[model samples]
Target: MDKKPNHRLAAHMKEAGASNKGLARRVCEVAARHGEQRGTTHVSVQRWLDGGGIQPQTAAFVAEALSDKLHRTITPTDLGFPGPVPVTPTAGVNYAKSLPEALSVLDGLARLRPEDDPPSELLLTEADVDHAALTWLVSRPDGLSNDSAGSRRVGMRDIAAIRTAAGYFMQLDFQFGGGHAHKAFRHYFREEVLPLLDASYSAKVGTALFGAATEISQLLAWTAYDSGNHTLADRYMMSTLRLTQVVDDRMMGARILANMSHQANYLRQASRAMRLARAAIEGGRAHSTPRGMALFAAHEARALSTVGDHTGAGRAMNEAERFFELADTGDDPEWLSYMDEAELVGEFCHCFRDLGKSREAVHFAERAVSLTDPKYARTLGFCRMVLAQSQLLNGELEAAVTTAGLAVEAGDALQSARFQRYVTDFQHAVSVHASNSTVQQFNEQVRDAMTQMDDE
Candidate 1:
């Protein structure tokens, strides 16, 4: 089967579920693994898929990347190319519209999924919500709409406000832990905010408001999930997906699937997780961004690893690597900017840990941990918890306990009940060694710490 560079890479990336930036991130990550310098810029990738050929020498790296990420070997032939390499699709989808219309699309996108048919009405009518505070929420970004408002351009500042607030709430939940703050925020979104927008927003203003609201709502759902409120998390997910439908952002819509995959993994439903992850991959194909593909590949590896399909998972990892290798450093989308080599390695670390490759797990975990910012406390805590588990399995009880302690401490300061639960799971593993005096002591310390944390 012969295919063009774009077609083969594009098809494989669709199966892997990566965004352009995500693909670049993964490539950067794989290159770093081999001690080489690589950049998958959003712009350059877009240029390549737009018909400009990428660097020929970088093709093999793309295959190796997907192989490492997906845990399976893929030939250039698989990507429909000859010789040693294949080009990764770097094309991106950008939605350009007025702020108000963009917002509506973003909100609509949050609610819709590729698997679902289009809904008739993406947003709730004013009759469906209250409008008392809607006017206030829909005010222009800059305090001045009276004079030159006609010529004022809407910029990232508006999006930044939403992102900043979303981040703040996320942090608040993480630090003190998810409880009233999470619930209160959800309530505000559902009652005070949603209703207000429903009742009072104009066409454009309403769309923008809904878009921002949907992003915030998703974060709320994440917080709730972290706090172990799965039912509420599900509700939020539903709402979030609905909002995306109104907002009309396909990439964000795909993200909803990614989050669902995470939820499935938490419940130990590996098959379900893999399905959702694959859906995300397939859905993002229209956009053909590297980041989306990379993300999909990582999730596939995660699901495969969870199901104990080490070989399959490894193959998926390789597929992820291939796409990453072909990533260039230009023409990217903002939604996918957070992805990079560090995050890719972090995903691999999880896969290795689940596959019982303790040494590789520890190595990747350390590398992943070192690459991230301290502000990502919850992620770091997760890495530490996994590392602790690996240590315990290796019979390094003391080291395990100490590492677990650090995870616990990090979790305490962050707002993730989920991370705390992982810590508990590690402790449970420790309890199996009750006959060992050191293990017993370690268990006791864990119990005491948890009890104290709960009480406080």
Candidate 2:
């Protein structure tokens, strides 16, 4: 209990001409509209002003009743009803309506959103994702400024350093997986990248700064996705999209949308994944390069495959391949340097594997595994697992066991929770052969690999 009288409520009641009994009746009426019933009375109103207790839900109705009477929004706080526990806003989800708001939202992500327990409020919702993507599609680019008040001079060199750090982090993610280097990643982001948001820069430098921030922010989201923190990753991607809008980075904004598509598909929300992918394709059309379009199309194919749409998946995959073939023109962003031929085909491996096209799945998976550079432990790990799945589907149990063992070896060198999931998937697929000793050995290998990696 607050143990303090709510004097503000008395003043608002007079201004709204709400008598105690009349307001009590109105509160009951308001609650009924929302399918809630309340037994409020004039005596309850007096008790409330005398520091007596009230149900939180009933308190809301009282506020709403006054709002209706006064024809103005009336929150409980304005009526001196400050509850003991504060209500924290869900941070890092909104697609900011302006540049300054985006920066503030990003700041709150690290501050207001507690890392412990996560609670139910920290969970991601499909409605939030839909709103973000829709806003990005319709909202005009912001008129950004270089006249931030802090007066700390930001230069091209700082942006270059950030760009370099982003590249390094991407490399680390590709090599050691997302579980590695997050401490260093957040340290650099908080200490180095964030301060630049308020620093002064020339118009050109400001554009470059936001562009560099876009890459780093996307990396932040990607790492979270790989580490299996879907809620956190979704927020990071939302922030990235807002940054892209501020800078009018059509291609980059679309890339963030594609990342959302990938994450949605990963979480088995195939329909929403398809929606995000199409949104990316539509949003990126004006400025995206062949490589960028390839990625968006690949995500579409992935979603289609997951939904059992073989024809649609194949068509989208063809578009991805055609765009990728044209990607040698060098019009892609520095951030997309990773979506090479191998990565494009790796998308095919994922699509075909999901569609149960064993031959094609194996064909693309082996090529992707071989073509992926040795240092890309995560990608290699992914390709090997897909190959194992294809082999298992083709009834090549012995080869499947061998290739899955190889994937487990790669998983040993990676720290991704998603990699661990892939291992689990392969184990489940081969578990039907639980009576077989070789399959059992492979399952044991997977267990050992997961034990060695970051179990978070």
Q: Determine the C-alpha RMSD for candidate 1 after optimal superposition of all C-alphas.
A: 23.0
TM-score of each: 0.61, 0.78
- The TM-score that candidate 2 achieves is 0.78
Candidate 1 residue 412 Cα shift, in angstroms, is 2.9
Q: What is the lDDT of residue 387 in candidate 2?
A: 92
lDDT of 2 at 217: 74
Full-model lDDT for every candidate: 0.59, 0.80
**1-456, model 2: which lDDT tens digit per residue?**
135767899999999998889998999899899875665667768767765444445567889999998899998778876432322345666676656556655644543222322444575677887898889998887755533433257899999999999989999989887767555676677557776765567889888999998888788778767877777777778888999887788999999999999988988989899999999999998889988999999999999999999999999999998888889885667888889889988999999999999999999999999899877788988999999899999889999999989888756868787888888888888888999999888878766766665355
